[model samples]
Target: MTQALRFRLATPQDAVAIIACVRAVRGEHYPIRLLYAPEELAQAIAYARLVFALALLPSTGEVAGLAALEPSPYGRTGEMGVMMVLPTHRRRHVADDLRLLLVAWARQHGRRGLWGEVLAPVADSPDAACVSQRFTENAQLVPSGIALGLWPGPGGERQSFVRYARPLPAKASSKACRLPTRHRALVSEILGRLNCPVSFTADSPASGAGILDAKHEEGLRSWVLAVPRIGSDSAAELAGAIRRIQTHPDVAYAHLELPLAQPGASALCELAEARGFFFSTVTAEPFHDGPGLRLQWLAQPIEPNGLLLLNPLARRIAGHQSREQERVRPWAVAAAA
Candidate 1:
């Protein structure tokens, strides 16, 4: 950025300044609630749960811009976000400096990648544009998935947040994955791109009942329904869960995850697709119980060319998902007509 600023990790003492910085743009609308609570923000910094890269005016000691990374409890990846550069600091590369600092920190922590959602640089503002996508792309991150109808946006509209990721340098993820016949090609392509090694065997049906780990993001009204271990009963239970979530007025999205190495995963994939889920992402670990596949269902239709997918592969994946969503949810088309 400008030679006027210096960059460093923010200490707990800087919590109040961070809140002031956020409030200047979002007031009470910032989704990161902790940023508004000085005590909680300070605690997060102290505990290292919220790692912030701060830029300051070297001469005045004023906070100029900030970026932060929240490590996933699942490990291997961290969500990098809360990117804010004051209007005064926009063009000077302060954001670029903060982003690079976070990426370096993530590497030091043994993270495989940095992940974030496409959102306006200023939180809770009416203009939910694609500028966030361009910003992440500027940081060397590419569109890895689309989180359709992820959160409530301005005008009571659901936000379709695109997922972005930057893969750090690492060796192959030696994962043994059982390929679902219908999704083999897509999964293979994703794995190849990630330099992941996959070994497949004859598909065998799961003998026991499946186990599901369900989590709801309260702020965003999004649900992550992961079937780490799939069994004969997974489809039935998962279908019930999906149906329940879909009917909730507040629920906007459901992310269905199935392990690639699980035999019953393929059947569950078919079942979920039948329920209108479409491809979103393929992960190896820390992102999910990976190497696995992620599918998503949204309450709203994604407009044509809605997501600004930055890379060729990401665009191809989005196009395939668009077609697949229609194929799976033909009833939706009929109902609309």
Candidate 2:
């Protein structure tokens, strides 16, 4: 029996089905926990700010898959979240269809880009090869970082994530943002290779800039630092923030998001690199409209050589990370001493 698939924006009525789908995919090896409760999900859907899409069988209205464009904290980007297809629907192009639907929704909503993170297998594993091939078609995947203890297995397991981005076509009047001098070479290299448009603006740093917000996720042992602007005093502010983050018990990773348009961005980025931060991804501006650089610092060691990198850009970033870590190791050790 052939069934027609219908894709539509989810309403509050679809919350139960969406939650069920999420729980079903999670099963025994739940890689991540759902951040929203069913009631919360329903409320959020009713609010109509974040867009969730449901793939259903028209005959019985059975939800076959689900995807969502979650609003970023900074309001300029939408993260592709809760992408799942039923086990029975696997390898049937449902995922691709869902991805397209999500992208279209993001574009309709004026998102600069759509970002997603996929769990990848370890290097040399048979599953790694298969998964790599799966992402090879029409996906720009970048190797992110080792998410320690992110998955559940026999005891527990960690998974490496591959981050991918898809930029939407901007308005004709939108001007390109300036690329920082220190990161220009690498960023240019990345832009040259990827099919995404990442524009930056070079402008004077906003006055009285400092850390605007910070959030810590206990589950991931990660801290996200948001900086509205990076000015001359950013170094002192960031140093204090990093010191606090490092001192946090069981902290594994810290991420900083800074506006790419701000003046002194390159200088601040250089300072961050000296303090062990490395480029992770380019995301939409958090505070205003533009692109921002997402940099990460890991307190724990990462075995990049053991990661399964499907994209060339991912591999290059991983290599750069390894080299940067090595270059900063001695300084970190001596500083601690």
Candidate 3:
């Protein structure tokens, strides 16, 4: 008998069911680690910044799938995670239905876009294909040398992730921001593909009190740093933070998010580059206050040729990433020498 599928916000009672669904679907490729414990799941359900949803088989009263939408560093952007569907329901399009439900929820909440990072060993992997069919590929993130303990692959190997985005129905006006002169053209092209407007501003010294927050994801061996403010001493503060980040024994990748609204943003970006960070993308507002820019520094190498990009812009960005790496190779070599 065909069972009717229903979707709704997940409650505390649904935590166990959601965990089971995740284990059933992802256990083989990426075993459930500490991230989705019942307590954590419950908290995620109750967290104001996160939306958790479950797909239920009404007739059988079984939770067939689960997904969550968590606020991004960008205020108008949300990241979709905890996406899982049971093996028995694989052919039922339960994943798609859950995603659509999540998208609707995000739109109702005034989100400009939604994105997801999926474990894609190859471009055509089933997981990557699903993301391509549902979302536009934004960029590929290389693994930060350290194993992602939470997302273990076959034989428990860590897998790199690919970023995909789905923009909702929201109009974004053209806005000017400072960008690196060397890669301005490529960055402009990427922003155009994303329907974002850009006007480069002249670089200026960052002044004011900048706040820096750092969180280490032990499961991913990754460090995420958020700078919500830029002050006169911001450059020194940022440099200190990066130095500390480099000292972490297990660090794989470090991400720095800077607000675009900051007058000294362009200059700060230049400072970051000198410290080995590379341009990633311009995210929406970092906070409820305004938009932001994202940059990354990798402690190891990433093979770009293996990326499966579904969008032309994504491909272009990948190409640029390769070129940028080459452009920086000499400097890196000299610094090492």
Candidate 4:
């Protein structure tokens, strides 16, 4: 059954075929707006900015499966998202082939880790997104955390994502992470699963200049404020940024990423949590210079109880995050109102 297809890295010529395969599998709800743009997508593929391993039906040269390998800004990690196979190709090893091909390409390109976000189900079909979870688990990737309400729909409705992770040999970092004991326990559990070495610091270092970068998602009306270095003024800078961002009535939310392995990350993190940001997840990949401790501040409130997670680990995360969300729920509600 698997021998019926040919798998290889995609080129600009595969732009039409990839788009068609995505449409055949998901129609217009594919959510990746890049698929709708032919020229830019082709350019992205040509430049290697958007790399894909494609499964093609040699008889007709039609794309049967698609898997992407998106490298992060830090270049230490590659995101493995949506090894999608058309419905007609189900029960075959088409997805497995595409997944393996993408993994091989990532290794050849020096990607140390493949810890990425798996988009949670949308409001319409909450369980439909589990296909990726099945694949992630099959690849021996451990499910660590959930970025609750991370993805946004065209109608302003937001969805969540599971943190799927599998770190390669080169990705193991022996860095010491500083955090409160409460967060430290879960993070420790997750890190143990990834086999990443870690030691805990007794206290968060005080006083440095906040070194960070802020990027916005115009389409999703969200922001990712990444703090690589925590300075004495980081909390202030973040507060000012949050105030400015929230002033935009249509802006959905803001995500703050702190370098967990860095010394004052927890101190700055504590301050952010006080300012209405709540736990999202400890990112599987390295962000800034190390693993990111991510927190989110939403302009709207989402019912955490409503999450429909089938996997045991996912359900466990839902429970943990439900409590985390509760701590900051009042602040989010007041801001939204």
Candidate 5:
């Protein structure tokens, strides 16, 4: 028997159904102990602001899945979230259709890159398997690398996560920067300012960035950046962060915010440039509960993929668009000394 399905953009009115679908899927595929409340869902929708939609079965007008695309300050980059299909709609190409639709929407908006995280089963059991393999395979995406272990919660206690990527067809004109492990200390310090609670510092030259886990070490989510000593608010602190980057032979990198509202932020950026660092890519908080800012370089370099979480959705979206090699915004290179 042939089946019929329909898809459309989701609105604020559909928030309840979207939440239900996500919660149901999480119960089976992920360990989301703290689910979002109704107000939280509203806030997430507000933050995402650009293409948020739900999949609907035309025959019955039932909500089948939820997907969204969000803006990243980085040029031509956007993040994908809430890609979920209801329990009843799994294994039916519903996700494939929704992902393709979201990609088309992103390409139309001039966004060439997309990113999302997939969870891996921490323990060897059928209960913790990664469920979105089919979505990545159908899109013909390439695995930039694995995230290894990134999960929320106490140190040594977080679950494992995976990073996936797909280069957009339209990004042929775009070039990404690649940095080595030596710059991890420098990048860590800059990103630390925007995302605290998880800070990094270089302990020894050979060790690179020595990740301090307030809890345990193994199995915890380690923040990998070129520079160390993130989250400083003083000139001396910034100086130290720069020194670390300068001394390290690795590529320099850091994620900085616009620095408009803060005091002395521009001065710090100025100091960074003098010390041989520049602006690379913009990175915002992963969730609504985090800070928003760009990852500025102090003395490190930029990664080849342009982001920590390589976006598979970006390429998938690029495949559905007609535009090829269109430029959006130029990379934020540091001013010359």
Candidate 6:
């Protein structure tokens, strides 16, 4: 017989069951290695501060299936992880039920949207993708984007991750552009001089951030220029800037550099969440790159991986929520069907 599924906030006591579930579902549909280690089990529990776990009961309280709701960086956003249904629980729609429970919780808790990434298993079995595909379909999560990365195997196997989203029936508003009061002219100069392109910084209360090397900071930092990269690429520049921000004593919170793709944006957004920055708003469209070149706002954070829905879908959800809440009460629930 199919077991009844239930959901609740996970407690420390649930660690044993949770770990067992992880083992059962291991190596199937996730980049589990990046997020967990044998010693990091405690860290996982700690990291899941904003989590809700789903389980199926054989009778009174035995877990037969399980999934977790862990925190995401971009303010109220959160991620669904380690969704596992034991072999016996297969075909029961427990995954769908758990996802719904997680979504409902996010809607109520002021989260803007939900993001999920699915990985294929190492085995030749099609069951992994089969089950994940069904779950995404039932949840109405559109395959809006993909992330490809090389993994160990023949032909340098490329793992595929699909993106899914669900907006609350209630208002899920995002942040608006706040014009900066300082550093406009200086930033304009740098942009004009470098022929810089892209809205690379978040909306600043003062002048928006800038892209300055050490020389730039040494000379014309009279205003608040939200610098892009002190070095070449996004990662190195961000890391360098973060160190500078830490030592400068004059600088405030740090800035960001986001990749434009759904998966990249989501990954960077998760990093932002771990760091405790609130996502503000997302600036997109053809951004100015140089004198004659431009690039899409792939990923640019106001504050380094700070709170902001740089993702288009997520941004929309946040904006919609905020607008609806503005019209009425933010927390008023819609009637159930």
Go through the candidates in order and give the clash count of each: 0, 5, 9, 4, 36, 36
- Higher TM-score: candidate 4 or 6? 4
The TM-score measured for candidate 5 stands at: 0.47
Summed over model 2, clashes come to: 5
Model 6 residue 90 CA deviation in Å: 1.0
Reference-based lDDT, each prediction: 0.73, 0.64, 0.63, 0.74, 0.42, 0.40
Name the better of 3 and 4 by TM-score: 3
lDDT of 6: 0.40
Q: Rank the candidates by lDDT, best first.
A: 4, 1, 2, 3, 5, 6
lDDT of 3 by residue, 152-179 (tens): 3466445655555553244477666666
Q: Give candidate 3 regions above 4 Å deviation.
A: 28-34, 59-61, 118-152, 155-158, 168-171, 285-291, 329-337
Candidate 4, residues 171-203, lDDT tens digits: the string is 466667777676777677676667665668865
lDDT measured at residue 83 in model 2 versus the true structure, 0 to 100: 75
Number of the top lDDT candidate: 4
- Per-model TM values vs. the true structure: 0.78, 0.79, 0.82, 0.81, 0.47, 0.47
**Model 1 local distance difference test score:** 0.73
The superposed Cα distance between candidate 2 and the true structure at residue 74, in angstroms, equals 3.0
- Give one digit per residue, the lDDT tens place, for model 5 in 1-337: 4346678876656667666676667653333321245565566566555466677767766667877776653345566655777776777877767878888877787665466656534334364253464556566544322332245433433333343444544312211212223333333332332222222222211212221111111222122222222233345545665454435443222333332113333444454445544333323232222222223332212122222222453222222110111110122222222
Off by over 4 Å in 4: 1-3, 116-139, 152-157, 167-173, 202-211, 218-221, 229-233, 308-313
Minimal lDDT window, size 10, model 3:
141-150
Question: After superposition on all CA atoms, what RMSD does each candidate show versus the true structure?
Answer: 4.8, 4.0, 4.6, 3.8, 14.7, 17.0
Most accurate candidate by TM-score: 3
